[model samples]
Target: MAKSNNNNRNMSVEEAGKKGGEKVSEKYNQEHFEEIGQKGGEKTSEKYNQKHFEDIGQKGGETTSQKKDKEFYQEIGKKGGETTSEKHGEEFYEDIGQKGGNRSRGGRSNR
Candidate 1:
């Protein structure tokens, strides 16, 4: 009976040791998981911030380009208008003068 009691006590101690080891392992695993999750979150945030800044920069460039395009079109339109005005003014005066001179010459000749 004494030997049997000693064996039972040893079994209980072994079971307790296994339970304690399992608890420690579980705690370590949980802490490791938390640390990994925190690192991943930080990396993701950094990437997002970099991408957001790039997008803002691209938008600013696009706006500047749009303004430049508008100015270019306005300058072209102004130049075109000036050229047309000059051409039409000269042609109109010359055409009317020639017509009057031809008519006067024809009347004198007929007389």
Candidate 2:
């Protein structure tokens, strides 16, 4: 128990929570977190429909976009693009471009 003040013998709620969280972290590994996250996501999905998710997503996106500037978006976009390029290589973009071209030309690909 971590004491918040020198005068008090009791631990603060924040300090107790931190101590518990540290203990839990020491006991659990990455797989435990992933398993719990998957279960939680499944339960959330069962409780919420597509519309609920879409609405929340839209609200979150709107709020985030309002808070962030063009430069911030550009920086994140560049980082995401770099990560994707590294993961998928240049051929991934070529394949997507081909698919887009095919769709634009009424499923008739030039290639």
Top-scoring candidate (TM-score): 2
Task: Give the top-scoring candidate (lDDT).
Answer: 2
Report the lDDT tens digits of candidate 2 across residue range 1-111: 676565778897887898789999999999999999999999999999999999999999999999999999999999999899889977889899999989999999677
- The local distance difference test score of model 2 is 0.92
- Tens digit per residue, CA lDDT, model 1, 26-98: 7787778789889998987777887786888899988877778877868888999888777788778677677
Q: Candidate 1: what lDDT?
A: 0.75
Q: After superposition, which runs of candidate 1 have C-alpha atoms over 4 Å from their true positions? A: 1-28, 50-111
- Per-candidate TM equals 0.21, 0.83
CA deviation > 4 Å runs, candidate 2: 1-8
Model 1, C-alpha of 62: deviation from truth (Å): 30
Q: Considering summed lDDT, which 10 consecutive residues are worst modelled in model 2?
A: 1-10
